[model samples]
Structure formats: C-alpha cells, structure tokens
Target chain A: MDISAVNALPYEDFVNIFGNVVEKCPLVSAAVWTRRPFVSLADLEAAINQFIDALPESGKEGILRCHPDLAGRDLHRGALTRESRQEQAGAGLDALRSDEASRVSRLNEEYKRRFGFPFVVCARAHDKASILRELSERCGNERAAERARGIQEVKKICRLRLQDLVRSDNKL
Target chain B: MDISAVNALPYEDFVNIFGNVVEKCPLVSAAVWTRRPFVSLADLEAAINQFIDALPESGKEGILRCHPDLAGRDLHRGALTRESRQEQAGAGLDALRSDEASRVSRLNEEYKRRFGFPFVVCARAHDKASILRELSERCGNERAAERARGIQEVKKICRLRLQDLVRSDNKL
Candidate 1:
C-alpha cells in the first residue's frame, strides 16, 4: 500500500490495519488517525513516535506491560499475536532448546520484577543468543534508563510494522 | 486469596495477579496498585470499576478494542489469553459449528466496521446461542449506548475474574 492508500482509509480501516503497530496498543493508532493526511509515511511515523514519547511514565509503563513476555507462555501455547509470533519465530525464539527457553523465562521474570515491565526488545532484530545477552545486560540498568530503552525498542518494532503495511519508498 | 492477602501484596505481585482482570488492560491494575490497602474485595473491585468508569470515551473504546471478538481468530488459533480462553470455552464458543463460526466472523467484521471496535460480551455469562442473539441485537445500538454496554460487560468479566482470584465471601 502507498501513502495515498493509507491517507484514504476511514478511521476504522486505518485502525484495523495500523492498530497493532505499537504491539497491543490500538489506542496509539486511534489517536494517530485524528492527525491524518500525512505528508509522507515519515510524517505518520513521527506522529506515532511523538505520541509514544509524549506519554507520562505510567502510560509508557502501561504500553510496555501490554507486551507479552519474550519466549514465554503465549509463545509456548501458540497464543502469540500474528505479528509477535512472526517476530519471535524470526528471532529463533520458537526453536529454543528447553534449557535456553528456561533461561530466557527466568531472565524475563527477573527483568519484569526489577523494571515493573517486561524486557521488551525488537525480537526480529536479534537471535535468541543476542536477546538473552541484551536481557541480561539491561537487567542491571537503572529503571529510568531501561524504561527509555524499552520504549525505543517499541518504536523500532513500530517502524518495521509500518513498513510492512505501507510502501515507504512510494512518493506522496 | 482474601482481602488481607490482596492488601499485603507488593505492587508487582498485585499487578501480576490482578493485572489481567480487565482483559488486556494491565494499566488498570498498575494504576489501582497506587490506591492500595483495600478494605475488602469489594473495595478493590470498586477501585477498578471507578477507574474504568472515569475513562474518557477514547479510553473506553481502547479498552473494548483490547478484547478479542467472540469466537474470532484468537479462539480459532488457540491464541487467547488464559482468562479469555477459559471464559470462551465456558460459553461454548469453542464448539461453534462452521456456519455459526462464519456467521460470527461476518457479524464481527460488520460490527467493527460500524462501531470502530469489536463486539464484546461477558462470555462466561452466556452460551453461544445467547451470545449470537446479543451480538445481533447490539449491532443496531447507537454508538454511545453500545460503548457503555461494552464497558459494563467488561466490568462483568472483571467481576468474575476477581471472584476467581479473591474469594468474594471470605471475611477480610
């Protein structure tokens, strides 16, 4: 789809296509729809990034909390959202050996316990080994820094999702 | 768990146990944790209800949108959150015949197109037959009334989930 196709969507259509761009937070897309008629795909993305960046601490935490734990229950049970399933599989999370899975699970819990939100990374950007490494390192970060890091990862995930839906190379 | 147990919980534990009481909106639990030390289970529930009740229209719609459509893709894919999976099973949504499933999918799409959110009902409280009936009827409701109705059903689902977690009759 091109920017014109995106710009032409009704509110519901816009939301249906873009709602889960920010993980499970459709409210982001709903809010973004109000600022429509994007000059380019980048403008639309900036709108989303601005909305996320403008959120208060609790709101950002809420967005993070909405995310499923990496290689956790949902993935094991075949219950991941379509985007999440693909991303996790892309990172080889779906094929983790039992030992690796257990280690990831433990680190995920420890991360959440420390940060009050799951350790979120753009899974498609890293394999299981790298994900585990980052999860371990980030667990030691200050809460404020970790929170900032997680939100930035969310935006990375969003940019990829947006690219999947809209042809970024197409001129407005 | 009793009210005393609930009040005694650390914030992370509290959220872990009650975070999903409102379906996918852990933010409710996260926010409610700040107002802790409940006098009783009822008081905790009231805290949750009031937080939901106080949301602006967009917030309410976002909450509804978080819910999966009855007998929809998540159910078919075995991807529902555990709470949702059980509630849907209790309502016989898992056993829908092909025709019933198709009807539901069509109605769900139509409903979303019309209302900007999915059709939400407290599945544990209704069998598939009654759910279809309600879905058919509510499809015609004015947007404001339907939004209010969906939120109320969310509360009903919350109440049941709370009952599952904290015994309603146990004295504080």
Candidate 2:
C-alpha cells in the first residue's frame, strides 16, 4: 500500500496492518494511528518511534519482553509469530548447527537470567555469527545501557517492517 | 507423510515436523521421538499425549502459557504462529465485530489475570460465539481444574495437527 492508502485506513485496518511493526506491540500502532494522514512512510515511522521513545522504562521492557528469543525453543517448536520465524530464518538462525544452537541457547538463558528479559536483537540485520558475537559482548554491559541498545534494535526492526508495509511515495 | 514415512524420520526431522503438535512445547516432541516407529497415526498421537500427561502441573501450565490469546492483540497484529493463525481464522475469529473483539479481549485479559495463563480452547473446535461462551464459563473454575481442562484442549489440538501430518494406516 502507498502513502495515500495508508493515510486512508480506518483505525482498525491501520492497527491491523501496522500493529506488529514493533513485534507484538500493537499499542504502538494504535497510538500512532492518531497521527495519521502521514506525508510519507517516514512520517508514520517517526510517529511510532516517538511513541516508543516516550514510554517509561517499564513499558520499554514490556515491549522487549514481547519478542521471542532468536532460535530458541519457540523456533524449535514452530511457535514463533510469522514475522519472527521469517526474520530468524533470514538470519540463518533456523539452520544453526547443533553446537552453535547449544551455545546460543546457553547464552540466551544467561542473558535473560541477568537482564530479567530475553536478549532483543534485530535478526534481519545480523547473520548468526554476528548475532552471537553481539550477544556475548553485550552480556557484560549494565542493564540500563543494554535496555537502550535493545530498544534501538527494536526501532531498526520497526523501520524494516514499516518499509515492507508502506511504499514511500518518492513523487511526493 | 504417511505412517511409514513418519516412522522413518530422523530425530531432528521428526521434531521439526511434530514439535509444535503441543504448541511451543518441543520437549514433548523430543521425548516422544524415543517411542517412534509408530504403527499408525493413532500410535503417534498416543506417544505425544503420553508425554503431555507425564508433565507435572507446572509443565502443563507452561504449555498453556505459550499459546497466544484467542482473537487478542496478536491476531490484530498478525503476529500469531502460522498454525495458530490458520486455526483462529478457521474459527471465524478473523472477522469478529468490533464489540465481539472487545469482549474477547476483555475476557482474555480477565482469564489470564485470574488463571495466570491465557484461556486456551482449541480454536479449530469452536466458532467465535462458542469460544466467548467457554471463555466466560471457564473463568469460574479453580486454577487446578482449569489447567487440566486447558491441557485436554491442547491434546485435542495436537490430535488434529497429528492427523494433518500423518495419514492413518488402517491395514496391519
């Protein structure tokens, strides 16, 4: 759909299409719908980012918590949301070797144990190797900084999802 | 796949195919793989059900917790697992009127708050109206009984999924 199409959506249809742009956080889409009549896809994304930025720490954590662990049990069980499954598969997470999967699983468990939420990464932007490297390095960071980093990844993911959903009208 | 094809699968392939028969509980699939060389579809289902039955209370609740709320935010967001999306859509959950959607959302929240897990009836078995009715009725039960009832529904869901995957072999 184009910018005009996006701008014309009813609240329900808008929320339905964009609700998961933030990966399981529909309220973000719902809130951003009020800022509609977007000039371009970028404007819609900005509204979403602004809403995310204005959230309290607890709310940000809640958003991060909604994400499934990359290549974790959910993937194994085929239980990930469709977007997540595709993203993880794109990152080569679905094909992890036994040893690699074991290592990732161990790191994921430890990361959650330390941070009180699963490690959040934009799998679409990283191959499994880089994902593992970042996960290991980030494990040593303090909680607050890691939360910020994770939310930034969430925005990156949101941007990619938005790009998929809304065609930018370059003619505008 | 037929019963013979199912019986011939490697552990990894087997798990990949049937892991979600229990909805985010790959452990059940992993455990049941040990009993393979299933004589028929019924035998394969029996193995899966036995694995679920063997779980302690917490494990069963854990399985229930893995399910998304029926016609809740995930559905609106298009974030449901593929199987769940199809089952919910088959139940006409995709077309709920605004008021029905709101009622389901409210009942879902209350059910979770009361039981500590989302209300999980197999969407394949009921249309939207019956789902709402059950959600209302089941809310009055104690946690223990609710957990058991939810698991039974999980088994019914598993049976349907298994039927889809493996054709029954009527001949010996």
Candidate 3:
C-alpha cells in the first residue's frame, strides 16, 4: 500500500480504522488523529501536540481509563506483559524495610481515602524516592488538578505505546 | 518504598526486580533507567529523550522480540485482545468478495517478503489501507534504519503497556 493509496481511502474507512483505536485508547487516537493525513513525521508530531492541547476537561477520565491499576497482579484481557508488572511494582515498592512498608501501606490507605483512587504516576520515568515524593506532593493537589495531571500522564504513556506498536510491526 | 530503602537494598535485588523488566523488553528498561533517580516529572521525560538518542545499532532487533508473531489469528502469550482479532479478520474471507481478499493476501505476502517477517503495525492505530501503505513505503527503507526505528517504536509500546498495568493496580 502506498501513501497515495492511504490518502485515497474513503474517509469513512479511514475513520473506521482509527475510530476503533480512538475508542480503545482515546488519547493515543487523539494524538495520532490530531495530525491528519500525516505528510511527514514532523507533521504527525505537530498534530499530536495539537490534539493533546485540545483535549476537553471532561475527556480526562476517558483517557485515564486506558491505564491499568498499579500493583495489579492479575492479568486482564489487554493487560501489560508480565515483565511490566514486575518492573512497576518493583519500582513502586522499591526499598521498603518492614517499617517503611507499613508506612507505605498506611499512606496508600490514606491517599486512596482522600482521592478516591490509588495514586497514579508515569512510573516508567520515576525512581522509588521520586515516586514517593510525588505521591506525597500530589496528595495535596486539588482533586481536579490531580485528575487532569493523571490524564496528561496517561496521554504521554499512550503516545509512547503507539510508537512502540508501530515500530514492532515495521520490524515484522 | 522510600528512596533510601531502594538504595539500601542489595544491588542484586535492584537488578533482580528491574532486570525482569529489561529482560522482557530491553528498550523499555533502557527508556526508564536512562532517567534514573527521577526527581521531577520533567526529569523523567528528559531521560526518555536521552534513551531515544542513545539507542544502539542493534536495539531494533532487541525490541522486535517483544511483539507477538502475526498470524491469521493470535498465538502469543500476550498480543491483541480477542475482540481485536475478530475485528481484524473481518466477518470472514467471504465478506471481502474476491479482489479485496486477494489484495490483502498479496500485501501480506509482499510485506513478509520485504521485511522477512509479517507486516506488523499496531493495527489499532491504522486502517487496512494505511497499514498497507506503511508496509510499502517502509519496505523501501534500508534494513538498518528500519530496524532502528522499529526498536524505538517498541520502546514506546512497552512504556504504554507499563502505564496501563500501574493504572489498573491503582484502581483495585
């Protein structure tokens, strides 16, 4: 298939393919679609930026839905690989001695009580201490800001994920 | 776990935990570790950039191992969801009439011939036509460059998967 052929696709077909992606992971779809008819890679990136900026305040929760629970040991239909689970949990609970583990447990309880959800961060980029610090700091963020931030973080994660998917397919 | 606790752990433990992640997906671990001791969200992103820049010549091959093989159906431990497979195959070959079906088969064959592997793309992000176009254009790329790009994309995918895992845990 050539770019010309892709460009020639009826908008409905194009939308249908992309719409499924958007529905599954709206942020990623938004990032990709924000740049329509991708003339070049740079243009594609710009569209991604524009999409991120244009996301509605109400849409944040939808974006957040794409992420799985932290320390969620069980596998779901479309969960992360086993390797990913170990990595996030390892980093999340990194250096807890017995006492610190209790404290972390307590904090987890209290934070959940306050926010109505487990603390979420883009764990891939954070170390143990940094994550804890974020946990503490975000505990104080008004619910709205924290939720918005979570959505933003999720979007970043989606972009990264989509990029990886494309790369893997190309290799195949 | 506190930062000190993470630091206090035996180096082997750190390696053991983080090692699984890297082992499952080296590009992802590299993407995460490149940003060690992430103090701020900004720091974490900076590390991701560094990882992208420092990717090795062979990194693409390393990432390819993370993707499941492409078949008329799914077969790997973790690949597309069941629903995704159903959607990808369409109602059946009969639904495609003859020409459309032949075109898909031919494109799949050409893609495999040029890349020495199945035409892989995050089907979620593309329609049949766009995917076909990508297949043709990417076939033109030198193996080395294509391989590098593929690995980079895998890194992105792994990170997104990890995020999903963490979010799911938090929800629980």
Candidate 4:
C-alpha cells in the first residue's frame, strides 16, 4: 500500500499492515499511526526509529528480546510469521547445510552469553557469510556499544520491513 | 593432535582438548576419553555419535539446547568457543551483512518456536545461502522427524569439531 493509504487506514488496519516490523513490539505501529500523513518512506521510518530510540533501556531490551536468535532454535520448527519466514528465505538461511548452521548457533550462544540478548541486524541487506563475519566480530564490543549497535540494526530491520509493508512513493 | 596422540593424552588433557566439541554438553569429551584407543579420527567420531544417538529424548534435547542459534546474537558478540569461531569463519558465517543476518535470526526464531529447540546443522559442510535454505525447509518436518534430523546434525557438527581438535590421519 502507498503512504497515504497507510495513513488513511484505521488503527488496527494500519497496524495490520505494519505492526509486525518489530516482532514483539506490535504497539509501535499504532504509535506510528498517530503521526500519520508521512511525507515519504524516510519520514515514516525516521518516526519509527525516533520512537524506538527514545525508549528506556528496559523497553529497548524488551524489543530486542522479542527477536529470535539468527538461525537459532525457532527456525528449525517453522514458527516465524509469514513476513519473517519470507525475509529469511530471501537470504537463503532456510536451507543451511549442517556445518553452517552450527557456526551460526555457536556465535549466537556466545553473543547472548556476553550481551544478555541476541544480536540484531537487518537480514534483508546481508548474506550468510557476512552475517557470520559480523556476528563473529561484533561480540567484542562493550555492552553499551553493542546495545547501541543493536538498536541501529533493529532500525535497519524495521525500515526494510516497513518498506515491504508500504510501497513508498519514493523508493528506499 | 593425531588420533593416536589424542588417545595417548592423559585423561584431563584429553577432556581439556576435546571437552567442548558438543556446544553445551561437555561430558561427551570425558566420556569419549574413557572409550579411548581411537585408531583414527573416524573411529573417534563414530564413538561420539553412537553415544549421543543412544541417549534418551531428554538427554538429546539437553545436548541440543547447549548449542546456540546459527547466525544468532552470540556470534556477533564474539562469544563462540575458539573452535566454533574458526569453524563458522571457515564457512563465511562470520561476515554476514545486515540483510542476511536478519534472515538467519528469523529462521532460528521460527525453528525454535516449532521444535522447542534450535535447528541443528553441521556448519562445516555448507555455505550461508545453503544453510538458510536448509533451515527454511527443515522447519516444516514433523517434530519427531525434525528431532532425529537435529541429532544427526549435532553429530555432524561434533565430528567436524573433533577433526579440528585432532589432526586427521588423512584429511577429510
């Protein structure tokens, strides 16, 4: 749908179109709905990012926790939403061979152990090797730094999902 | 670290060297130590797999949970064991950019949600895209079937790690 159509949509309908960009934080869409008539996709994404960025640490953690581990346990069982499934499928994570899966799992475990949460990133923009490389490298960051980085990653992910949900007047 | 050398090492040393081949389940290394006299890497790997295969469902799950999500948060934070890091690095999961990272996280979430555990696969055997594809496909399997698949994947992972731990008599 276009930006105007998205703005015109009712509360639930607007959320229905966009709420899932953040996995557990469905209310963000409703909040975004209040700031309707976005000038462009950039405007909408920036609003969404601003709202999330302004949240307290606890709130941010909650949003972070809502996401699953990359190629972690959840995907093995077919439990993701349709959008999430398609997102992963686009990057080929859906057909990992045995060893690549293990590498992904190993990094995930170490990252959570250190950071108290999963690493967040925009999967739509990367491939498997680059993800692993980043995962392997990012865990070295200080907790605060990683947390900040994670927020940025979450923004990227949300922005991409938003783009998918709305056919922007101007492309991202 | 040839098999003969691995076989000859003292008990503690043996466990120390091989203890973490299976992610969370460190006991495998100790157990493997007791069943020593490994003539080749294949013999050592076979014994480990056989023991794991014979475990009860709860035991299997316990071992499974010990592993992290593929391309998950831990990798980003540099939390993987050295062996895990190298293995993942070998397969290029260490360098995933944003979009691929998202795909892995989504697949992991879906798989765990359905199977009550992360999707297990041998990382040494596949590239990132293949890993994503397999993860997407495997999540559809029946729970029992998926469990069996996970166990096999675990075995594959362990074997690869073991090879790294023990210099193979003949390269794999």
Candidate 5:
C-alpha cells in the first residue's frame, strides 16, 4: 500500500491492520497497540510506552502465552533458520546442564508456582552462556517485579518485530 | 553474568554477541547498534555509519539470512522467532494466484534460468499483496543491482533481528 494510503487509513482500520499483525503474537499486539497511528517513528515509540502503561492484567497473561517453556523442545513454531535455533536451544540446554537442568526445573516450577506462568525470555539474541547466566539470575526476582519485567520484555520484542516486519515490507 | 563481566568483555566479544543477534535481523541491529556500551542508558545512541562500518561482511550476511524467501517456505537460519511455516507456505502458494501464479512461475523459471538461486524476501513481515508487488517491481531491476539490493536488504534484516535478540536477552 502507498505510504499516503497508510496515512489515510482511519484509526480503526490502522488498528485493524496492526491488530492483525499483533493478534497472533499478543506480545507484539500489546506493544504495537500501545502505539497507534504514528506520525513519525519517534511518535510510534512513545505510543509503545503509553500502551505498556495501559496494559491490563489479562494482557500480561496474553504476553506470557507467546513464550515457550524454558529449555523445552517444541518451543519454536516453524523451521527456524538452522543457526538461530541451534544457538538458542544450545544455550538453553547448556544452561540446564546436569544439576543446572534440575535447578532450572525447580526454578521453572517455582516460577510457575509463584506467577502462575512459565518463565518467558526472548531467546533470539542471547548466546548459550549469557542465556544460562540470565536464567540463573532472573530466577531470583520477586514475583511481581519479574512478572512486570517479563511483560516489558515482551513489549520490547514486539516493537522490534514490528519494525523488522515493516522495514522488510517497505524494503527500507 | 555480572554487569561488570559484561563490561569487562573486549569490544570484539560484544560485537560477536551483537553480531549473532543481528545475523537474523539486520535493520534492528542497524538502528540500535548506533548506540554502544551504554554506561548509562542515557548515553546510548550515537550514529549509524560508524557502527555499520564496524560490522564484518559475514555479520552483514548473517543479517541478510534471517529473512524468508519471497515465495519460499524456509526461514533464514539466523531467524530468531518461530515463524509459522504452514502460514508462509500457504501464502507462497496463494501468491501463485492463477494469473500471478503463471507470471510468477514464468518469472521463477526465467529468473532461475538467468540467476542460479531462488528469489528471497523476509516474507513473515509482508502480506501476499505487498510481496506480489515487490516481485513485480524487482523484476525490472538489472541483475547486478537486484542482487546487490537483495543482499543489502538481507543485511538490514539481520541487524534488526540482532537488536531484537539483544533487547530480549538483556531483560532476561
């Protein structure tokens, strides 16, 4: 669609298009919806902040739903590029080595026990070691703070994904 | 790892970590890597040119690889998220809509006849219509320019994916 046509879309239509993108990925939806019709990319970002502020309790749950179980297989959806999946899964499994896996298992249990959800992390960017370190560290956060942090992280992932998606489409 | 440990790593290490993230998504890496080793989050962004200059060619290719084919089902090896393969495949098939399909088939045959590889795009971010638009638009470009542009777009994608990965991992 023309950039001008995109500009002409009613707020609801814009929302609808954006909403379609985000709906499959609630974390993305929350992040994108957090920002509406962006006059400039900067404005779009500010909207992300506003959207995060407006998040409902249920929205938090929705964000959590997109995450795969920690160290669990079948976490990803499709044929992830060979290198990306190898890196993420290798890092996750490495973090869970021998006793570490048990510890992670216990932590996963505790995390779910406390927050009523799986421990979610956007695993795309992390290395095997760094991810392991994070898995161990975040296991210590108090429930409320961790939950809030998780939602925020999801929001960040969504924003990045949106930008990536748009840029790809625009080939800009 | 402790924040200090992260800080302690050589800049190359940081680049390596950052490189992995961008391998699948370049545009994000391009936007965010503009900022470096932020002492305070306040001191984050600087300029894009320097950071881009600092990146290796393989790093650039890694970013380019994150995108899905324009009409193919495979996600780039560097792709971080679980893109729906079923969805992408269905969409690819859909793009071959009778008239367009024949044209695409003819183009696919002609293009492959001329070039040794399949046409590629980061399809997850695009809808059928926009992709079709791009396919037709790109058909007119000179072979060398199209290859160059295609490679460049891939790099941008890798950068974006890398940034997204880093942001997610940092929070974890």
Candidate 6:
C-alpha cells in the first residue's frame, strides 16, 4: 500500500501488518504505531530502525537473539516459521546432501560458540555452499562487529517480508 | 625469532605467520607484512574455518569480483592493511550518520563479497527470549540472505546504506 494508505490504518491493523514483518516482536510494531503514515518504505523502515536503535543493548540483543542459525538445528526439527521455511527452501537449504548438511550443521554450532550467537548472513542471496563458507569465515569476526551484522541481516528479512505484505513505488 | 618465538621476529618474519591464513590471497598478507607478529594473540585461528563452502553461484561471483569488500570500499584506498586503525576505532561504525559508511562497510559485503566460511544447540541451553528468538529471527539472513538483507540495507544506505549495519551477535 502507498504511504498514504498506511496512514489510514487503524492502530491494531497497522501493528498487525508490521508485527508479522519482525516475527515475534509485536512490541516493536506496536511501538511504531506512533509514527504513522510514513512517507516511503524507507520511512517505515527508518522508524523501525530508530526504535531498534534506541533500544537497550539487551533489548537489541533480544532482537538479534531472535533469529535461527543458517541451515540450523531448528530447520531439521520443522520448527521454522512459514516465512523462514520458504526462504530456506528458496536457497536450496532443504535439499542438502548428507555431508553438506552435516558440515553446515557443524559450522552453525561452532559459530554460535565462537560469537556468543548463531552465525548469520543474508542466506537468501547465496546457496548452501556459500552459506557454509560464510559461517566458517565469520567465525573470525569480533563479537561486537558480528552482532552489528546480525541486526542488519534481521532487518533485511523484515524488509523483504514487508515487501510481501505491502507495496511501494519508493525504493524499499 | 624463528617460528618458535614468533614474538621476537623482525617485522618481515612476523607477517609470514598469518600471511598464510588465507590461501591464494597473497595480497591479504603481503599487505599485512608491514605489521609484525601479534604476540598477545592466542594460537592462530584454525585454517578449516577459512575455507569457502561450495557456493556455485557465489563462487562464480567470487571469481568475477575477486577481492573481499574489506569494510567495503575502504579496502581499496590503502585501508586493507590498516587492521590496527580499524580495531582501535570501534563504535565509530555504530555511530555512522552518513549512509556511505554503513552501505559499503557491512561485514556481509566483506565476507560474501570476500568467502571462508559452518550448529546445534544444546537447545535446552538458552531461553525463549534467546532461542525462538534465534529461530524465526535469523530468517532475516542475507547469506546472500545477507545480500538480500544487504541490498535492502545497501539500498537503505544508498536509501541511507538501506539501514546501517546491524551491530549484534545472534547470527547475522
């Protein structure tokens, strides 16, 4: 919908629209209700960014901690969100050969261990091989630097999810 | 100092130790050679974690693009070897008001757009705030999930660097 259309949404309706974008974080969406009728997708994303930026380190960490590992344990258990399921499948993550799958699985564990969080990247852009490569390389990132990268990745997912739910002529 | 006492080495020898860390990337170390042995560092990070996974698409792209985007374009202007300068300037990236730094400076870009690159959880190890938090959340990945994430943010930087790099460690 156009920014004008969004301004017209009722509070609950607006939150409902964006709440889905961040998955479990309805509070972020709810909090953003005060900033209505954004001028562009950038405006909407910016508002979301501001709210997240202002959050306590723990709150932000809470947000970062919200994501799963790439080709992670959650994937095998069928625990992924509907959006996540499609995204992972988009990258051929579900079709991994046994050896490939296990390597990715191991990387996930080692990443989380090294970084104090799961290894993250924008998996949709690459493939099983690239994702695994990133997992290993990023193991070298400083914790603080990696965390910054994590939040950025999550927001990307939200933006894509937002594009799915809303339309825009302005750049996203 | 010979290899045993890496600490005592004159500058030229020190660079030799880590120059081998990334194979075929002589520029990485020949550039780093000016810097000497890092005495305070722990044992060298394992080499296995340095291998790029079999990302046919990205691998092809990697061949095309060649160098990693160290802090993005910053690598090009005599900054690749300036590791010490960057390590000292923490939080500056987090505070970026301009989009350029954020857009080109993402780790995702540095990693995919450089590769080396791997999880399980004890599952019972962390809480929902940390776990489901991890699961549905990491879906925002730009692994190319990062690129997708990055393009969103890059568009953001390019829109503001889309969104500045997310600075956290849950996985992205």
Q: Name model 1 segments beyond 4 Å from true.
A: A1-172, B168-172
Chain B of model 3: TM-score?
0.51
* Model with the higher TM-score, candidate 1 or 6: 1
User: TM-score for each prediction?
Assistant: 0.64, 0.52, 0.39, 0.48, 0.38, 0.47
Of candidate 2 chain A, the 10-residue stretch with the lowest lDDT total is A163-172
- Per-residue lDDT for A70-135 in model 4, tens only? 786667798876766777777788888889988888888889778766788778889887888999
> Of the candidates numbered 1 and 5, which has the greater lDDT value?
1
Between candidates 1 and 4, which one is better according to TM-score? Answer: 1
Q: What is the DockQ of each candidate?
A: 0.17, 0.03, 0.03, 0.01, 0.02, 0.01
TM-score of chain B of 6: 0.24
Per-residue lDDT for B9 in model 4?
A: 71
Q: Tally clashes: model 2.
A: 0
lDDT of 1 by residue, A117-163 (tens): 88999998888889999999999999989989999999999999899
Please identify model 4 stretches exceeding 4 Å from their true place: A168-172, B1-172
Candidate 5, residues A1-172, lDDT tens digits: the string is 4344445543324433443222233223323432334576545555544554554443344335334455653333543333224435755653456776666667766666566545666565565566567766887888778778877665565565555545554522
Q: Chain B, model 2, TM-score against the native? A: 0.94
lDDT of each: 0.83, 0.78, 0.45, 0.71, 0.47, 0.48
Give the winner by DockQ: 1
Q: Higher DockQ: candidate 2 or 4?
A: 2
* Residue A159, candidate 6: C-alpha displacement in angstroms: 1.9
**Residue B124, model 5: Cα distance from true site in angstroms:** 34
The true-versus-predicted C-alpha distance at residue A73 of model 6, in Å, is 2.9
The native-contact fractions of the candidates, in order shown, are 0.13, 0.00, 0.00, 0.00, 0.00, 0.00
Over the stretch B8-54, how does candidate 2's per-residue lDDT look in tens digits? Answer: 76554665677677775554665566566788889988877776675
- lDDT by residue (B45-128, candidate 6, tens digit) is 211111222112322122113222323333335443332123213323323345545543353333432322101111223432
Q: What clash pairs does model 2 have?
A: none
* Highest lDDT scorer: 1
Give the TM-score ranking, best first: 1, 2, 4, 6, 3, 5
The C-alpha stretches of model 6 lying farther than 4 A from their native spots are: A168-172, B1-172
